[model samples]
Target chain A: MHFVDMLVHRWDLARALGRPYAAPDELTRVLNPCGGSAARLAPDDRLLPGDRPGRVTTPAIDDRDDRRGPRAEHGGPTALARRTGRKGSYPMWCSSVLRRPRRLFAVAVLAVAFPGLAACGSGSGGAASAAAPAYAPAATPTATSGAGAGGGTTPPSTPAPMPGMSGMATGAPGAGGATAAGKPVSATRVAIQNFAFSPATVTVKAGTTVTWTNQDSDPHTVTAKSGAGPDSPTLDQGATYQYTFTKAGQYAYLCTIHPFMLGTVVVTP
Target chain B: MSRRQLARHGAWFGAAVALSVVGGEVISSVVGGTTSAAAAADDTATLRFVQVSDSHLGFTGTANPDVTGSFAHAIDQVNALPYRPDFVMHTGDLTHLSTAAQFDQVKQMLGGVRAGSVHTVPGEHDAIHDHGRGYLSTFGAGSAGDGWYSFDLKGVHVLALVNTLSLEKLGHLGPDQLDFVRRDVAGLSSDTPILVFSHIPLFAMYPEWGWGTDDAAQALSHLRRFSSVTCLNGHVHQLFTKTEGTVTFHSATTTAYPLPRPGVGPAPTPQTLPAGRLRAALGIREVSHVQGQTTLAIKDSVLS
Candidate 1:
């Protein structure tokens, strides 16, 4: 699909610009998950009988029960991303996938029905983490405190969290213990500068409030990566958008206007 | 619905969620961007011009099977305007891949517009393999060193700048063009309403995506004394506006495909919205500055 082609293109650009990019581990995990997850298949993978010509399968949709909504947690690989043993971003991904009515039923079903397969995708996160240490949660906090116009907010002790890929494998040493206890950075301020969200990833305790201030001359947005997050109106210079995280999970976002300005919010319980 | 019927419904699916910012306040709306342009045109507006960007003429994506079709529809919107605009300015990206044929198709298609004159700048895509020799040769008449030039039109000075050539971290305006902007605006009075055009934004809209111009500040510094300045650009492929001092920056949407918002993803590629949402995401914008006004009144209407 075009998404795959785009992902490869992004890698090339990230390198060209000297920006850190996550290896396409989770993205290409299965290369073929059952039938409709991410990439369809490699040339060598055997095709399913129904996938062949003249099969005329009902539009690949599966209507799930209301109880198992698109946002419901499931163990599956197609999820946006999650560390091993952690809740995956699949639910949010499903919520966004449902935007297309024609494939809504099929993708919704894929999100909830295949959690068993989701387990396979998590193993790759741990391996990918070692490849990009610049994104580790520990080095996230920056020195400048982004407190409103009045000032007096101290920056977090940890370095600034990496931007771009928010899906680091924070699993405990033995793995499967996603309680990595992300360094709690009380300074919940993110500044938009040079077209990037400074401290691309932020860690906070559940129920904490975070604010994004735009320092760039042009407009930027704080939109959920899954199209399900509380999107902000376009913000110009000196404009700020605020949101409070009420749950513990990995919530990813990007500016709908400049999809390349990606950021993530990791909340710990 | 059948695939054909779903596509029929998809044509009307672009329900544009929009917002209007006046003087520093935000007003939001989620109307289906299907309203006609004539329905929003104003007769007494002081100055008027139609802004068209990202008309990727040769694009063949499922996002909208018929990019040329939608572009033609946009032309119809411009022709149907109740009052003829002083001039129609295409910010940039006229062709998807910068092909001679694509450029010709765009020129042939735009020839049908009812506006007084057609002016343009090059987008990175327009200069693809040919490096813009094709673009300048076709529409480069009267342009400066590159495809950047300025003209006085109906009391307004319009500058068409080409920043797509030799782009670095962001679109670049080398020393020559920056000097051109300096000398171009030096002769004009402080009261002239200035309209500057280019394919990429002159401001740092989102430098991460190369949406901003690297040395645009140097170009803008020359016009600080002007009472009104409107800078229009395409490339990010969306509608955004901002004002700083005497300058107002407007990033226009595309007549071809929509790209994700800044930081919404890893790249600014064509976005394929779910069916029934394409129209809301695609369309054209109309801008006008009244005689004594300091700001331009911009109206963005989506293709129904």
Candidate 2:
């Protein structure tokens, strides 16, 4: 775990000092699966041992698996991102590294050269990409296109994936063809800042997905005060969590991390 | 060296260190060294106590999926100590969301801890929604207004303060609390040892994150005459130490998740650490107050 911490710390330090950083080849090879198989990349989501800091045991990712894994026809940011489809394992590997212009090329080249591989890998990529899957894949048919759209424009400073709700919807209009009639669900955004939710009360349509973006640096969660309201994961600064209100009622919610941060979401028929 | 300079220099001593005031100047040295303060005390006479902070019970996040389990581990660690501590001071943030159920669960869990007694101050989380009325009902039995009170334990004056309430930009100690501090320590002699406990750090460790108290200086001024004053706090979810004049502040680590260091990120968000490292980041502190030493011997131990 120290290895990942050291790696993330190095990236954080480099970013803080305005320096460019790339992971060592050992971490890349050990963590990044050339096959791009989400199942093979599953172990990467768990904590790793720092016992062998400089040496990471390589996983078996070969060209033979290319036939078994997802398609790898085109290799640039768009193609690789489209593979983010149902499983978000690939973008999880890129994380902060995805923002660097050249790493995209490196990942693209990696994808083409290794036909089996669909995404690049780095330290705890799943942590950042976990926030992406919520809005990206469900709204789009390809499911994975959110990675390319959200990751491409995200700055290294904003390690969390850009709100896929905005970036992905526009970036991949073709992918949204399946749900074109009902696809473009305009989400009502609630700002969480200064330890309180802005506009404390929000009224939206029944099917509207109310997204809470934490503008505050401190962590916050949108939880139901009574019955079912908005149950969200911990939202860090620049990180977002959305809940679609399917029924019409007065749903009261508050930041579970800071219960005093109260807000109400009224859904109308 | 002048008294101010001596206290400032004494702060530099690392762990297992001892410090004392002599001729109006503080002197410090590594413990067990032939230092005047360490040599003068009898180890058996030391008053040993434990400090556990930010348990954040009922919290479940990626950083720590089982906060209740981890807090239980911390209490077990305290109980497994070779010697049961005189008392346990939980600096604050006992629950993630200050629900009555969370309070009850934490209270029952704390009851399992083997200590002389368990005391606490309120963290902002503890005052959630109701301004600490819920917390006061559960833990504020003998505490004064807003759960601030002081008591004498084995010749050491211990003050449990409430600075997490009515916070604006920083932790605030309103006039009522400040007055309590003045009156509490008014009769104590200059040589009496003083220990102040609060959830937010009294010193401006990082005001931008609301880590410091706005009116702590006033409270400190009332205790400045004492030969030794130590302030312990537990909000930032990380270990930090600062020394000013005669008082040294120590911020304890949480039994819950870890937060980013001051200015390390956009906000003091709980860091989602890689696996198997969460326990290393969460732990407890044991403080030993020796008879002759003005400063307590502080030792931080991580949960195994």
| Candidate that scores best on lDDT | 2
| Tens digits of lDDT, candidate 1, A72-176 | 132122222221222111111123442222233243223222332432453554343222211211000000001101112111111223333233212112212
| Residue B14 accuracy (lDDT) in model 2 | 16
Residue A56 lDDT (model 2)? 19
Q: List model 1 lDDT by residue over B203-242, tens digit each.
A: 6554445667767777888987787677878887776654
- Give residue B112's lDDT in candidate 1 (0 to 100): 91
DockQ, all candidates in order: 0.03, 0.03
Candidate 1 wrong stretches, greater than 4 Å: A1-269, B1-45, B280-304
Docking class of 1: incorrect
Badly placed stretches (over 4 Å) of model 2 are A1-188, A193-269, B1-44, B278-304
Which digits, one per residue and each the tens of the lDDT, describe model 2 over residues A36-66?
4321221111111121222212221121222
RMSD of each: 23.8, 19.0
In candidate 1, position A202 carries an lDDT of 73
lDDT of 2 by residue, B186-218 (tens): 998997878888998886654435666777768
Residue clash pairs of candidate 2: A35-A116, A35-A117, A36-A117, A36-A118, A84-A144, A85-A143, A85-A144, A92-A125
Deviation of model 1 at A57, angstroms: 39
Q: After superposition, how far is residue A186 of candidate 2 from its true place, in Å?
A: 16
